[model samples]
Target chain A: MLELVTTDRGSDAGNSETAVTFERLLDLISRGDREAFSELYDRTAPRVLGLVKRVLVDHAQSEEVAQEVFLEIWRTASRFESQRGSAMSWILTMSHRRAVDRVRSSQSGHDRDERIGLRDIEPDYDEVSETVEIRIEHERVKRAMAQLTALQREAISLAYYGGYSHSEIAGILSIPVGTVKTRLRDGMIRLRDELGVTS
Target chain B: MNDRHDDDDPRLSTGAYSLDAVSPDEAEAFERATDASESLREETDGLVETAGLLGLAITPVTPSERMKAELMAKLATTAQLPRQEPVAAVPDASAEPESAAPAAPTPVETPAPDARTASTAPRAESRARSRWFARPATLVAGIAAAAALFVGGGVVGTAVSGGFGTSSVTDASAAGLAEITAAEDSQRSTVPVEGGGTATLVWSNTLGRSAIVVDGLTPLPDGKVYEAWYIDAEGAAPAGTFTASGEGTSWHVLAGAMNPGDAIGVTVEPAGGSTTPTTDPIIVGQTA
Candidate 1:
């Protein structure tokens, strides 16, 4: 349900080299190069910590977790495979997963319980970005999200932002698990298509 | 019967799976099917990458100065600096007899490889092992004791998967996992997540192996995965990534080594996992 955009905005045409740079740094880390690891951490820690903070919403714990995330990158730098994904995606994916794990482990009883009652209410997701590129990317995601059906958007956001599982989302929405799955898939596909994210 | 339209339902759940929203059981089934279909893998990868943009979409915030310093210090300790002297020069003090050993008490149970090799090690020491496995508390204690031996570096080698490769390493890891899960003195802790769920950390000292059973946990969005960690006062070591088990619970087998008094933690990390933990721990269960 997405309209094809011919615009050059948000395209990865120029950022391909950045991915290689990260891969190269990871490769050096694998060979026991501390300097490369430091460099990699400098370039990605903010991006990594940002996602963690957003998901966790606790500054103190976020810092603790961020420290753990970077330490992990140092220990497992050898495992990074450039072919599987871009360095940014690889690094950010790690950040998001770590954040979600924290959310699920500690917040399930309290934070999640509070969220269960308020599942219908949409979160105010404001990205305060000064960078032109990030601003555009945020706008693109916002526009794409707006086009999804309300149910689809809710299902996706609940899982995406709330970090709720399919069954959890179903329980919150009072819908069948199958329906939850469908809406999540449909919304994501639409979003992907809208964003022209063919990577 | 007419062709079933629902046959495609599983394929479509790629979005859910990519987002870490699929139940563990369904995710496994999807993983198997995806293994047989390259197109599905590619499609899911693209979707996951697109989801990565969602993280980038957030406003970037600077980490605390103390965090950077602490992280750099932690990394410095863990980094394998070049050895100025040969291993022979160290005299393998750890290899000496009890009298030759340092006066300080050994914090961990160091089982010498020559003394108790993995092969000669008893596979089934007692039927109590099975019974202990049935009960969470008993199982946890059993694993904790077992972990002391495992992390003490007496095992043949630490059982770790070499990245995401499909090799015999998987078989070794699977076998190692079974041993660790079955190890005596294994311990477990079920901690509450913020919203409303439980994450069970089960680990063994003998095999230095651990697994986490996540129940009623929320799934992550695309571009993110759940990363396990073994944390102590020094810092954290990355265990690995995992998904749900489809039984409303996901079981993750930890790969990194653990020390006594170390706690098992999980955080929402990037798909692979960050070198350090970036988010607050959703749950942390003490091992020692």
Candidate 2:
């Protein structure tokens, strides 16, 4: 039976728990184990869909992209190198890239200039569940985000979540394109450090 | 102006690129730099992984139920990925089979709905034969016959041969394609063209590479090639151009940066290609 999980019980168990388990699941999937692939999909699809939805914003397109991502995982299971990082990270990275691509290729690509023309508009914050673990993670990112200057946070969010390029973010923020790039770089570096991302 | 920035700190943008905060043009430049240096690619992968963690900050939302069902249906009919040695097997294997239940019924339910998924052979061999039979003389009738047979038998045969174990050139390319598809940064789109042909575009803006493959085209005239263009409202920008192999697969590598609003198009041109398309585009695919 497919266990439909509403939460990441893996997180509650600890980071290593989910990370190691997901790694093993990917390994089994590589060995042509369809069951293991299902488990991996169940465990990761929520965040994958969530991440894609955050970027693309359209429900149907997000689903389409998410489906393709999973299909890719099925085909490329052997390519997952455990030495690189956790399976969740790999899956999320794929979701983010695919979603960003969908956004960039869609009408948003051309319409972006108009959207970015709206200077000083607030970036949309994706709604989060009030669950303790999720809230804790969100609060951690928020705290790390607090360390950035307002301009830095704005620049990072607009680019990362809004799916706008640096030039587009620059237009939106009414800053030099160079300034937008610098702020985004610095903000990501700080955020990475805050999250203890050694890589 | 850009030259000085490159000199000051060429790698400074790696952070932003990892976050996908840069334009496609900037991304192409960043990848060209990274591709030349293995260490640079590793560093970029690390940064991308780091940035990917921010995804956890978003509240998880479950996808629709249809997704899982469709995925299972696709997997069941399609040939499974080639199996590797069970070297990576987990010792606590008992837990593995429990999750296999939902996917088990798929193979029984959907035997062969579509030829593409129904055929168990690696894409190259199957595609080659399919294209040959699909040539103009008997094109439509041949495709119909092939499709009917494609669904009738191969599924059971391939399942039995899942990994009897032999490596070949085709397997190697399939592996490479898998790696590309599995790449965290790659994007893909498949579009159907005129005369029952299909085109697939797989590109990685971060890698500074794009590939377009047109399959099942009726054999073009000798000394002719299909030219590719990146079209926007302004006009067409020449992408790399190429001729199809006898099997009717034409592959083009596009190194130029692509922006949003750019759609990929193909036109029949003389060998090599022209400064501008010489015919109406036979196929056009939107990029976004």
Candidate 3:
């Protein structure tokens, strides 16, 4: 029976165990274990869908892309190397790449221009309905993001959340592409320092 | 549009690459550079990890129940890529056998199928096999027949003993061999021995296991045995050792999970088997 818990209920503050569990599930899924796949889906579907929806901004299309991401995860679970990165990082990276590909391939130049125009007015991350642990993570990330310079924050946000290329970001911000690249690299270096992300 | 100057340093693009903001061509070039540099790869991996953290800021949205049902159904039919061990850099001078003159084949990338959920999506099954079978000089007869049996869908759930007599295989190994051969996704490859006879390598990606059956090879002397090896992009790993009967037939379940692009090789070794191959492979079965 499927446990239909939408939120990450009972998640503790420190998510150290979550990484191990995801890695183990991926190992089992590599062996064609269906139950492990189900549990993995149940645990991660909400975030996967949420991330896709954030980038694509179309509910139906987001669902479609999310489905593809999960299917890719199922097929390539064997390719997940824990030594390279966390399982969550691998899953989310693939999800982000798929969403970005869809956006780049399907959108017209005019649609992109319209999206660029609307980027400044977009809403910030929603916090009201999220669980306590998620809210805490949201707060940590929010605080880290606030440390970046305005241009750094805008460029990183547009590239990541908006799925825009560095050139597109340069066009949007009226800056040189080189400046955009430098800002992105410098900003991410800062974010890694701020987030204390160790490889 | 002289953006060439902007990307002069591939390291500059790591941030954008992690965000999936680079064009596919730029991404490919950046990946090539990253592959050659260890520090750059570490930096990129760190930034990618940091980028993944940004995903958690969004509000979680539970997918519709129908989507889960469809995904589960698709998973039931989908064949997974085989697990791959990390490729360790080995000194080519010492690793390569003098007699085996063919250069090590480059690893082929198996492209994931497009996002379309079509049930009949074409897979990279042949491409996977072509990774190890790149040199035609290494190939021999019986491949067409094996491929025909695979395409005709006549091999699934067939008795394992029927292909290679189980008399030489232990009861436990025979059972394991049967389980792998019975799997729906099992694949078979044949390699003719250098001296005489042939070896058939059967494996299932779904089961992550493999078994080799040898027939008509000259029986080894009392102090010598045939050692099986799982050769991947890194180097050769000792699988197990077995001896042929007077009739020169032997079967053994390979040790450890079979990685993608691994080729099963048989070499003559001392009775206990060496950590590394002491002689050139007599038969190398290129497995998908």
Global lDDT scores for all candidate models: 0.59, 0.59, 0.67
lDDT (Cα, tens digit) per residue for candidate 3, span B1-288:
857664779988888888888888888889889999999999999898888778766678988655564454344334465555456444453343321211121121221231221221123322322433254434333334322322453323322223233343454565576556545665555445565555556678888888776654455545667788887766778899876643423566888879855777777677789998765566666556
**Cα lDDT, model 2, residue B235:** 66
CAPRI grade of model 2: incorrect
Can you write out model 2's per-residue Cα lDDT over B147-210, one digit (the tens) per residue? 3332443322222112112235323333333333333454455555554555665545555445
- In model 3, pairs of residues that clash are none
Candidate number that wins on DockQ, 1 or 2: 1
TM-score to true structure, per model: 0.51, 0.53, 0.56
Interface RMSD, all candidates in order, equals: 10.6, 7.7, 7.6
To one decimal, what is the Cα RMSD in angstroms of model 2 from the true structure?
19.3
RMSD values, in order shown: 20.2, 19.3, 17.6
**Interface Cα RMSD of candidate 2:** 7.7
lDDT of 3: 0.67
Off by over 4 Å in 1: A1-20, A112-127, B1-9, B23-29, B76-288
In model 3 chain B, the worst 10-residue window by lDDT is B99-108
In angstroms, give how far residue B211 of model 1 lies from its true place.
35
Residue-level lDDT for A169 in candidate 2: 74
Assess each model's interface with DockQ, reporting 2 decimals per model.
Answer: 0.22, 0.21, 0.34
Report, for all candidates in order, the number of backbone clashes: 93, 2, 0
Q: Candidate 2 chain B: minimum summed lDDT over ten consecutive residues — where?
A: B99-108
The model with the greatest lDDT is 3
